[model samples]
Target: MTSSITDVAGIEVGHFTDARRPTGCTVVLARGSAVAGVDVRGAAPGTRETDLLAPQNVVERVHAVLLSGGSAWGLDAAGGVMRWLEEQGIGIDVGPARIPIVPAAVLFDLPLGDQRVRPDAAAGYAACQAASRSAPAEGCIGAGAGAVVGKIFGFHRAMKGGIGTASVTAGGVTVGALIACNALGDVVDPDTGRVIAGARTEDGLHLLDSRRALLRGDAPRPMLAGSNTTIGVIATDAVLTKVQASRLATVGHDGLARSINPVHTLSDGDALFALATGASGRTPGMMTLAAMAAEACALAVVRAVRAARGVRIGELHLPAAGEI
Candidate 1:
């Protein structure tokens, strides 16, 4: 098990990272259309076509789901995904042309990257062209390229955060998750109840509990006004109604709540999408899927932090600057 979202039969993962600019995008393309639903938990989410994914909406399936950097501005990447799907003769037949349904969400990675040079349509297209079924290149790549976490102590003390993914199969069902771990709060391991990576102490050593910092009412949130977010997608092989898929997304938030301290706040945009291919029989019930989803989500967060390499802050790497 490569333990990536691609473990699901039809899903393929790809990344287009602009290393020089410290920004990029990731695309999760389904070989065939998949039933999709989304849940937005953060107070400042930047999304596209999310409404269409609702149970009552007209769209039934999506060709691809994009998670990108550049915040709201990066939404244009979805246009490129649409173009790619159209060229492949995918999407709903609307007579003259097939309209590929694609939904996307973005995180604020501007603080670490060359904010002016953000992901664009061309970058998105490149990502699709690069799609593959192999294990996705995690860490500081794709939308996670410029991702930073634990900024409650401000930019100087934050740690590098990036993309992480995990997948599992049990009781004849397979579930997977891909996450871009950028947030305003600390990341805690649910199993250990320990702060793995987050705001650092003044000496640049030891993890500081940003949640406690907030409770003290002394922490000045870095780049407040929606400067942080975490976005990603989850995939399963089970069959589910749009409503069930939506609920899957909601329960998936428990993963974030367990892994990210003080999450879904006014300064963070945390969103997760659920896609079901129904490629297998003997699917588990919704509650079971939700529990597994939460586990995958939490594990993915830890993986993202472990895989990430610190970005430069002045003359020092962000991680080293706060090395405890």
Candidate 2:
């Protein structure tokens, strides 16, 4: 009867944060046996567990998945998850030794609030330990701690972006999504359809029309080379094979499109993963169910932006949803 995706069974999430360092990570673990798949649509995605997700990959089950800050450097955090899984005796065959498959992905967050701080291996393990059967915290925490958006014109004009999640259930199948929103477009209110966060002019006003800004030759704005991405995970309790899960992940991108404007840009890395815990066998239409899941995920992205608190970077103000 719950409206959110946490209604799915045996899917748990946890967050580990360091406010002083201003960086953290989150872990999503399948409480029971589950099949998972991933789809990377972005050109600059940074992932470590992708090989394990492919159909051709030898590994079957992923003990845990990590989403963290530190850009490419944060990728090392998987080592900590691996270490913990090894202690638990997970992973494919390797003689008497066991290697835990902990797939992880990260986004670039070095420029939003702090540059020196990054998510480390210990942080990853801490997050994994915190996974539980509660609704995961959203906005300005974990992998989204340093996220920002609307930086196509540079950070000075950008707005604060963070983590968001939403879920939906139909025909006894539940689908949930968790997203770290760090993109080049503005976040909008899904209900009212208004720009809630994004770039602003010096006079303190929104672009009014984002497409116009891209078309107008008003003034050539300096752009950051690689400082954007939105990554997320979608989980369902429907029985699905790895290939079907991967296809579902791709379908989840529709949620991204509904929440963010001008998504999947060259400067942005947008990726989504779909995980299936075999708790339901009520066979539903695959494409129809996937579309509904995507819609719910998109709503969650909007909620994430609405929940963010403003972050100050130098003299410029990175406004929150209300301010935008």
Best by TM-score: 1
Q: Write the residue-wise lDDT of candidate 1 on 13-76 in tens digits.
A: 9899986688899999985888899999988899998999889987878889999999888898
Could you list the CA RMSD of all candidates, in the order they appear?
Answer: 1.7, 2.2
Clashes (candidate 2): 1
The residue-by-residue lDDT of candidate 2 on 68-90, one tens digit each, is 88888888788887776676666
Candidate 1 TM-score, C-alpha based: 0.96
Model 1 alpha-carbon drift over 4 Å, by segment = 320-323
10 residues in a row with least lDDT, candidate 2? 217-226
True lDDT of residue 35, candidate 2: 80
Question: Which pairs clash in model 1?
Answer: 204-322, 204-323, 204-324, 205-323, 205-324, 206-324
Cα error, residue 177 of model 1, in Å, equals 0.2
At residue 106, what lDDT does model 1 achieve? 93
lDDT of 2 at 255: 81
Alpha-carbon shift of residue 34 in model 1 (angstroms): 0.7
